[model samples]
Target: MKTLTALFTAAALALGANAAFAKDVQPDEVVKLVNAKTIKSLDELKAAAVAKHPGSTVTDSELEDEYGRYIYKVELRDTQNVEWDVALDAKTGEVLKDERDN
Candidate 1:
């Protein structure tokens, strides 16, 4: 029936969206790239982020390739309990964005 067809369509769309959002680079590949000096190591980037936000602890991190450019994103919580989102250039360990989460 039309109702069943609509349900299947909705399910397909949901799965497609999930797949798009699940794009991520493998950790070992990332390490290999860093070793080859193609990108800065995650540890160096994390250290830079920690230095930028003194007394903050990193909670999560991710590496992404967008438009052929590698970017590193990190989430942190400061001593005052404020959440911060930081983006860094994976190639040079530069800070691209540092924003406080609402």
Candidate 2:
């Protein structure tokens, strides 16, 4: 137990400011943006990506605030086992970039 605690302490120290917050987050930023109707929901963004490549499985996803613009980034694995990287405008649900990942 002590070893585990020490490891967690070391990891948290290494992360510095990136470590977990001291205060509890009230509302998720993404949820707040979607609720305010300023940006689309994650479901909408995921649907848009899947629409481009039917039968693909979303392997990973993330929402990023880039230059004040919200971007939904998705990684997909298609039926053919090809990996894809897809980026969308979170507000407009527009496909910003979609290409096979090497």
Q: How far is candidate 2 from the true structure (C-alpha RMSD, Å)?
A: 7.5
Which candidate has the highest TM-score of all? 1
Q: How much lDDT does each candidate structure score?
A: 0.89, 0.85
TM-scores vs. true structure, each candidate: 0.76, 0.73
Residue-by-residue lDDT tens digits, candidate 1, 1-102: 999999999999998876576456788989899989999888998998888899999999999876567888899999999999998888998899999988
**Which tens-of-lDDT digit does each residue in 1-102 have in candidate 2?**
999999999988977754333222233877788899988888989999999999999999888776567778899999999999999988999999999999
| TM accuracy, model 1 | 0.76
Q: Number of clashes in every candidate structure?
A: 0, 0
